[model samples]
Target chain A: MDELIINSELHQYKIMIGNRIRYDINTLLPKTYSTILVITDDKVAEKYLSEVMSNLQAENIFTSIIPAGEQSKSFALFEKLHTEALTYGLDRESLIIALGGGVVGDLAGFVAATYMRGIDYIQMPTTILAHDSSVGGKVAINHQLGKNLIGSFYPPKAVLYDIDTLSTLPRSQVRSGYAELIKEGLIADEELFQSILSSDLMSLSQDQLHNHIRSGIKIKAAIVEADEKEKGMRKYLNLGHTLGHALETTLGYGVLTHGEAIGIGLLFSMYVSESVYTIKLPYEPLYRWLLNNNYPLFLEQLHVNDLITLMKTDKKTLNHHIQMVLLKNVGEPVIKEISDEDMSSYLKQFLRKLVIA
Target chain B: MDELIINSELHQYKIMIGNRIRYDINTLLPKTYSTILVITDDKVAEKYLSEVMSNLQAENIFTSIIPAGEQSKSFALFEKLHTEALTYGLDRESLIIALGGGVVGDLAGFVAATYMRGIDYIQMPTTILAHDSSVGGKVAINHQLGKNLIGSFYPPKAVLYDIDTLSTLPRSQVRSGYAELIKEGLIADEELFQSILSSDLMSLSQDQLHNHIRSGIKIKAAIVEADEKEKGMRKYLNLGHTLGHALETTLGYGVLTHGEAIGIGLLFSMYVSESVYTIKLPYEPLYRWLLNNNYPLFLEQLHVNDLITLMKTDKKTLNHHIQMVLLKNVGEPVIKEISDEDMSSYLKQFLRKLVIA
Candidate 1:
């Protein structure tokens, strides 16, 4: 097992990445809680809930299984989970275990964040997409207005990333989840990026997948430690997220999985970066790589004007100026404020190329 | 104007208390924001919205007004505010000014807390009850099952407490607000407690009210600074809140103002203290004081068992044990976990006395 510690101004927690790390949960807990509530999605619960529950060492244990997918990250579900926690008599000393992918982790992590003005929770991520979401402690529920519009930077007590669970994920989900790993490489680690680009992401050996996931988490952990609130350097972590979020919002959440939207976003960001910086980037190769992986890269149904407007509403956008993370080099990400005229122009060129291809 | 600095692990904020401090808002802002959204209740907006709007120094200013009272702290309103914020193009660099009493402060503060994963907000408390709520960073919205069940401990950038706003409050509201000031005294400052006890709380002069409010904020600031998350010393600030919250939840919120419920809780905590610790408390004199001030001191509409059941669901309760803040003496407070049997007996005795009186 590989272990890493995430340091935020508010908390310092560990991330354990290995095969079947779920069983090590007892050893990872900071202390014994009064009661433990495991929050997962229905799909994840059907697969691993019983196994995880049997391994948890707590006197009183309860489970709240939400419907699987991005729709689960809604205010209605957020409220329902809190009601369930209260019904189960979960208190200050209680623990909430968020078990599943990004949707479950984000929703359940947020429930723990605001439940009684915050309590301890562990992220037991069961999908590859969760490799990024579970580590950074950026928990939130989507607002009707935008994705992650209502959220908090509340860190979890610990994260147990059991690779064994990833075996159940479908091929499309794996491709979607791998986009974040690619994002991690593009932002900070060129070697990791090159390795992922060279390898067939769909059929990586268990050991190879473990190394890439560990690298992605370490890069994220380092950035979060320096800027937990995203006042400065942390904004770089939103590499493709500005447009990715806009796409997710424009498409209506769950129309495209978060990672799939991000896969398209990564290509658009690279195109914008090359245009804005007048620098050469592996834009074509990366685009071809995404297509090869079966990522839904075409946004023919949407207009550049709509996506631009939605991008302005992004959390990263400031003063209604679309601030996008663009790469000057493979490992160098810069946040540039793109005016509507410039953003619309770049977005048009990028979308036009997608249509041609 | 009197200034007190509240120190928390996450952030440090200032509390400016005086007559008409609302006009001094621009001076108190830590920095200029991109946009400013003022969130207040309809009642407060009628009196001060235009004046506040005229005084605020921002290029873009927007106001979101909700219905007055505790009902405003619902999930519906919470979601509405976030939607309004997004509609107005408020972003990470924008600020939210909570421009009413506790309801507005809590709802707006929670919006600011989770808006774009937290942003800068200032608390412009418009009532005496806010003297306590405004100082602490405990921001939240109410759940259907309980009060403040959904929330975060995100502190404001600053607090502008204008004593001038108190003149608009009704006599009942004054009595309701004064109970918290009295709680501040009972838990900490004996001299402040004695001064308040001797005075006619209903009719204090401007200078006297300013001094008492400042002192209350100082006591609270000290406690919050020592323990921001209510992990230890901060729980002392909940001296009257355990039963106080139970009463508010039982009474269906807004039926009894928060401070009024707290006034009754103060009396109950004293009663429990006397029973469990075998110590003398000024229960009778305090009871008479509450009656003299026209605080609703009777619970004939409710049963002790129902309140007890509700109390068990309190955020402070641990492992199904009712942990309450009890005064050992006038100036000292301690948290004691009372058995269900002891709690039921003490609650019945306290109610019986209230009935006879």
Candidate 2:
């Protein structure tokens, strides 16, 4: 297993990334903690929790499972976990192990952060999508009004990214997770962007995939280190999330995977970059490439004005102004305020042009 | 306004304690942030939100009010605040100002910590009881089965303790809050303990009472500084809290203020400490002192077994062992693992003794 140390302004934690690393938790977890409470979702608990449980061999390991999906990451579910943690006897010395994807990580990490005002927790990511979500100490739950509206910036003691579990993930989930990789490249890495574009979007060997995942994580770690709270440079990572969250909320969260919504949002941001940012880039070729790779742009179906209204609820929006991360060029992003008129006009042009294609 | 900077290994914050200090929020708050969101419970919001809003005159200032009670300090209420915040256009640059007592401070501070992966927030304490709750930054919500089962250790940007608002608090609430002062004295300050016992518990002059409030906060702040995450010294703050939470949960939270339940719990813990540690103290005097102060030591009403069962849900319990903080002697506390048999027998003796008196 390869280990990466992420040293951010708020906290520093170790991330273990490799195959079958979930069973090797003892190498990283603290020996003093007598018991562990592994929090997971119904979907993942049925599949992978027992394997993780046997590996830890905890004197008193407990499990609390909630339903799977963004909907389950609510205040009600959080309360249930809290009561369960308390009922099972979690103290300062007890560890919380989050054993699932991003939703599970965010929710369980939040439970750990708040349960008795913080305790140690380990992340055993069960999805390829979690590779991006599992890193960067951002833990939170969604409010009905907005995506990820309630949460904390609490890091885990260690992250066990067992790649072997990724084989169990659905194809759509894999594609969805890959969207964040594209986002990492769009913000910082020119070489990574080129690599993603050149390689087959699907059907990659394990070594090549791991290299790509590590590159994405490196870029994210650098951003988090620079600004753990997203006051400045960290906003770059929200390249597609501002619109992506709006789509997820407005279109209904369960309708699309987090990465899939972001994929569509990323395409819209490129168009914004092309028109409003006025950045010179190879846009036509990139658009054609996405189309070839089966990225359904969905421009013809979505309403522009309605989308802008939904975007207002995003955390990135400042003072009623809709702010977006627009690409100055490939591998270069800048936060820009988009006027409603300009955004609507741009969306109209893209819809007309894409429909004719 | 007296501004005290608390420098701890994990957290550092300024505590501004004085009268009518809300006016200084602009100067007291971090100059980096632009917007502010005032969070309060419905009771305090009705009385004081306008005053708070008028002082911190920002174009983007917004107010959110939740139902007032321990019941409101749940995931449901937290989600309400989260949704309200999003609706009000809160962003990373925004600040959340908690304008009520413990419930507001805990819930709002939690919302700030979680919203957008952590934002800045200030505690503008409106009630005298808040003097203890506002300072330490232990923000949380209660689950259905237990109190403070879900929470985080995110300190506020600054705590503003305005003495004027205490005038609006009912005598019952003020008396309820005084239990914490007695608790503070019991654990660490013999001088304060004697002074409180000698003074008129219900009728101390405002200026004289503020001094005690400040002293209690000072004691709490010092303990928090020594151990921000409750690894060691901070556990002393949980002196009455373990059994107190059980009493509050068992009796039903609204039936008693947090302080009242803790008051009863304190007596029980003292009895347990005297027996377990071979430390003898005058039980009659202690029981009489609590009665004179209007603290109801209803040993006959509550079942020992039920209280013990509820205590098992406390986060302080490790591996089914309830680690209770007991008074070795007044001003010295010892956290010891006690069996259900020991606690049950002690409760029976204490009840029998109270009946004879």
Predicted structure with the largest DockQ when compared to the true one: 1
Tens digits of per-residue lDDT for model 1, A123-190: 99988889988988899988866788889999999999999899889987888888999999999999
Residue-level lDDT tens digits of model 2 in B1-357: 666777755457888887777766666775556678888888998888887787786767788888888888877777777778777778777889999988888888888878877788889888766777787778887776777767777788888888778878876677677778878888888777777777776677777677778888888888888777776777777777877888788877788788777777677777788888887864566567778877766644778888788887777777777888888788787778888888778868876766766
Clashing pairs in 2: A114-B151, A151-B114
- The CAPRI-style docking tier of model 1 reads high
Write model 1 residue lDDT over B1-357, tens digit each, in one string. Answer: 887887778777888877887787787788988699999999999999998888888889999999998988888898899999999999998999999999999999999999988989999998888888888898998876678888999999999888998988888778877888899999888778877777786678888788888888889999888888888988898898888998899888877888989998999999889987899999988888888878888775577788888888888889899999999999899999988888888888888888788
Off by over 4 Å in 2: A9-11, A28-32, A42-47, B8-11, B22-34, B45-47, B282-286
Candidate 2, B-chain TM: 0.94
Give the chain A TM-score for each candidate: 0.98, 0.94
Candidate 2 iRMS, in Å? Answer: 1.9
